[model samples]
Target chain A: MRLRGIAVVWGVLAVAAAAGLFRLKYEVIALEERLATLTHAIEADRRAIHVLRAEWSYFNDPDSLDKRVGAKLDLVPMDPAHIIALDALPFRPKPVGETAGGPARPPRVLNPGSAAPIPVPGQKPATLAEYTVMRTQP
Target chain B: MMPALLRSLVRRSSRRGAFLYPGAEIRDLPGAQGRHPARVRVSVEGQAKAAVEVGRNRLAITAGVFALAFCVIAGRLVDLMALNGGEAEAMAAAMAASDGPVVGAVVARSDIVDRNGVILATNLPTVNLYADTRAILDPEEAARRLVQLFPDMEYGETRDKLASGGHFVYLRRHLTPEQQEAVNLLGQPGLEFEPTERRVYPQGPLAAHVLGATSTDNHGIAGIESSFDRYLLEKAEPLQLSLDVRVQHAVRDVLLKAVDRFHAIAGAALVADVRTGEILALVSLPDYQPEAFSGAPADSRRNRATLGVYEMGSTFKLVNTALGLEVGGYHVTDGFDASHPLRMAGFTIHDDHAQARWLSIEEILVHSSNIGSAKMALAIGGDAQKAFLDRLGLLSPISLELPEVGKPLYPDPWRPINTVTISYGHGVAVTPVHMVNAVMPLVNGGWYRPATLLRQDPEAPPPGHQVVSARTSDTMRSLMRRVVTDGTGRKADVAGYLVGGKTGTAEKNEHGRYRHKALLPSFVAAFPMDDPRYVVLAMLDEPKGIPETHGFAAAGWNAAPTAGAMIARIAPILGVRPRGPETPVAPEVRFATASGDAGRAVH
Candidate 1:
């Protein structure tokens, strides 16, 4: 009885090994196929990126850029005189009420430190409210 | 001669001392070991049993060895076939082998790029369609199908090629990827798709002359392409040039406006970094498209900046005055006689923009006085002037990456008259490239770095020989600056930039005689004259005098201002910060004869 039982166990182990081997083989094949597909996809993406970059350069060419939005954008090449460094700007102005000669304790100038930057030529003019800076602080 | 049991019985009997009886009846014995002759002994006794045990042990040992060997072979087979995923390498090799050619087919010869990593010339992957007529059983049917895919292809021609019974015939080349897929979907026999690469210029005609063109077979035929063919064929990294496309665009933009406004036949310009000798922007007008340059006018295909040698008019005065200071050891305060035109060796050395008085060396350049320049050149003589120009890289073809470089034209015999004329910019002819090369040392503290198209590392600048002293360079800078403020190049000054330069308005010598109407006017400008950083050279060919220019086609009216406009636009791009005072106070110049026309620009 013991001998017969051992024979039965050996048969079960052989069957399990065969089943595992079959699964492993298919898994390898599946992984290989996936790898190849991904490689091809990567290659295709690279080619597409190359083409798009070329197109980007063409569109950004100075002639085309000028033709496309040069007028409508209210833009122009920055003149050297206009390209002042930030350091060249006057240090952050003192709270606006202090410079505008308002009363020492004057009604906090309604909106202090809210003054907008002066508009450059060809830019939209600053609104009256944008002219307020230390009015709020005072 | 007995049965098996009988022989065993006989041996046992012999062991029992019964061998004396031959031919005994073995059947009567207890078979060999038990009851039958074939029945083997289950167990033996004494010495007979010992001998039988030894023989049995030998059989078991032999069987064990064979069984172990088979077990080992089975394990190895399982290991290779399935266990540990150790599949046969040959199987994976086969898979990759099927894909190897497909992957290898898409590479190009090489790419060409600008210094900023902008792709100038690149390859686009395409497909070529061919047919094997022998394998194609129904040529008419295939051609009919092909016509639907390619409407441009004539059915008759395609049918003829397919029916020629030849092994291979091209149906189309450079098909788009979408079209390639459409042809593949046809799934017809005898058709093949071959991967091909087509060279394309993304910037179009922007840097066409510098990049050049290639043949259909992908061989370089001109420009940098022809020069680097061997290296390009072996490497995949891009060939990087020193050109800055943004600067290039800026230059082209400014030159186009100048050429159009002045109604000039052609134009050329270049900008170089004085410290490194790197040419940032090189422009030649009437440039051809790199793709189909063969159909363009031959003159448009020429690289005027590097190849067209012009007499260069008064631009040569920059070199002459430098010779006066550095070689002749003349001081900036020294005076030269310009009171009368010097008639030397039959050539009337008269100045069109005449200052009929003894003028200082600095004032001579400011006035653009030909008589003054010729007299100065006379002091230096012929041989010394030639040696000076030779040091400036003007005597021979410029050493550069482009194959289009031209050899400078000068009088070979070194005559005295040639010296006088060459000094005032009439006798010697040089390309705009040579002129730019000559101007660099005058402003960059005397480092005559040859302008190179290959991008250079800023940390390791190329070595150059000094052709002038630092003091002479400094003196030249201030003198040229005065030209912009008080002399013929007044229109060439940009506010706060401290621009300075010399104007050359030379007549073209056509058929061995000078044509006064055919003018080649040019301007060479250096900015922030205190310490010059960039040198810009602009030239216009045969510009007509317009009413806006007051009917004058001189360098001051056209080329000088053109360079001024270029400096204004490009200074900010070249990282030159606008600072300091807008206009500088002019110091008192000795012997400068109170000048007129501070309001009028002259050359």
Candidate 2:
């Protein structure tokens, strides 16, 4: 009687284990399908982005802009006289209610959180030999 | 008795109660004998017991058969899952290997961009349409519809391809998405779409010669595209060039107008940084659309600035002057006699500007005296002059980043007469790029920076050797300033830009002699002469004299004024700070006062 009871218990456990294994096998197949779908979608999005970036570049071409909108917008080349030294520009006045000379706000930076030093407006730009901005995004 | 019991078992099963006895238990079953043979032994005789033994043997054989089947199945599972991971790894490797070229093909080629990241050339993903020709039910009808959809497709060609009965045929390539949709809406079987990439030029002929074009297979065929094809194919990043489209537009705009006004056959213009040797703008008019470069006319496809070698008239005077200063050991103030024609080596050398008296080296250039320049070149000697021009990179092809660069034409033997003609810019012929490159070091404090189209790192400039003393460069700068201020390049002088340059008007050499009607006029200019930063060059092929030019198709009339307009247009975009009159061209103050009198000889 004890042996029969033991056999019955083992049979039930084996049936449960078989059911779990089949469930795991199906889950693997479903996960693989999902992975393939996501990969294809990501690839498709990347292709779309490439097309959009190219179109953006096309729209911003200088010669086309000059032809299409130069006269309509009354655009003209900037004159050397229009570019002034930093000292020539007047300092911005304090806000209307802000106190002067007491705990002034820190300066606003262009590239926030970056460690590069803020450029002084009137400083001479670096020479072409000294300037390098190749492949900054890559 | 055993047979009788078997009979009773059969009768018990078939008829519900055929073997019924008073209080009889369930009738003995033959199939149950294997499990409960003890009852059969007690009820039946010795013969029945032997039959039961045979039943037991059959049961054992059936159980063994089932066990062997399960063992075989388990062994196959293990073989598939464990012992031979090698096949699985190979399949995985094959998948990974197939992935690499697909990604590479999608990149196609790196973009060609201007210095400011404006796209000059790029690639767009597209779909190509193909067909299983055998699947088409009606070739003529389908071809007609296809021709209607894609107007560029020929009806006869499409029909022929459709009826070819081939397994696969390409209908069209590089189709737009809308066209793909229109084709899909036809709902035809066996039609397929193949994704691909095609090179595109966004700016369209703006810098066509610089960006070049690609072939149908997406291989570069010309210009920067050909020169850096390998690098472009390998790298995914954009290829950055030194060209600035804004400056190029200014140059193109001015040069186009000048070419139109002068009625020239063609034209070319270039601007380069004197210090860095970076070309900012290069325009060769009669330029073609890069998108259709292969089909463009050969005349428009010629890269005039770097390919067309011509006898650059009086502009060689700048090199002659520098050569004189460097190797001839002539003082700027020393006088050469220009009062009469120079007869040397079976040639009569004379002057166009004609100052018929003793003239200084400076005066010779200011007056465009061919006789005086020839005399100076004779003193410099043929060998020394050749050597000097060679050091300036004028005797050979310029080491610029273009496949179209032409080798400068000069007398290889270095004859004395060759020296004389070369001095006044006659015998030697060079492309416009070499002219600009040769003139750069003379005014840029004498550094031989070879021209490059690639954008360079400003912090560590490419190393260059000094070709002349700083003093010679200083003298050349002042002399160039004087040219704009006083001489033939007068039309090139801008009020605040302090433009300095030389003008060349060579009678176009036909066969072995110069022609009177055909002309090649060019001007090379440097700005803010005190600290020269940029050099601008303009050249025109066979320009006719308009009424406004007073029928003078000289460099002074057309090329010089064109250079001036170019400077005015591009200076603002280049960020050159303009200033008012600050200093004189030269400190040595002297002018030839012999206009009225052929004065005393100083030579």
User: What range of 10 consecutive residues in model 1 chain B has the weakest lDDT sum?
Assistant: B585-594
- What is the per-residue lDDT of model 2 for residues A1-138, given as tens digits with 9 covering 90 to 100? 999999999999878756765576567557757977886777777778777878987887777787777768876766544544332233455578787567566544333332323355776534434334323333
Top-TM-score candidate index: 1
* Whole-model alpha-carbon lDDT for candidate 2: 0.83
Give TM-scores for every candidate, taking all chains together and pairing residue i with residue i: 0.76, 0.74
Q: Which stretches of candidate 2 lie over 4 Å from their true place?
A: A1-35, A80-138, B1-105, B581-603
TM-score of model number 1, chain B:
0.80
The residue pairs that clash in candidate 2, if any, are A128-B458, A129-B458, A129-B459, A130-B458, A130-B459, A131-B458
**Chain A accuracy of model 1 expressed as TM-score:** 0.53
Q: TM-score of the candidate numbered 1?
A: 0.76
The docking category that best describes candidate 2 is incorrect
Candidate 1: DockQ? 0.20
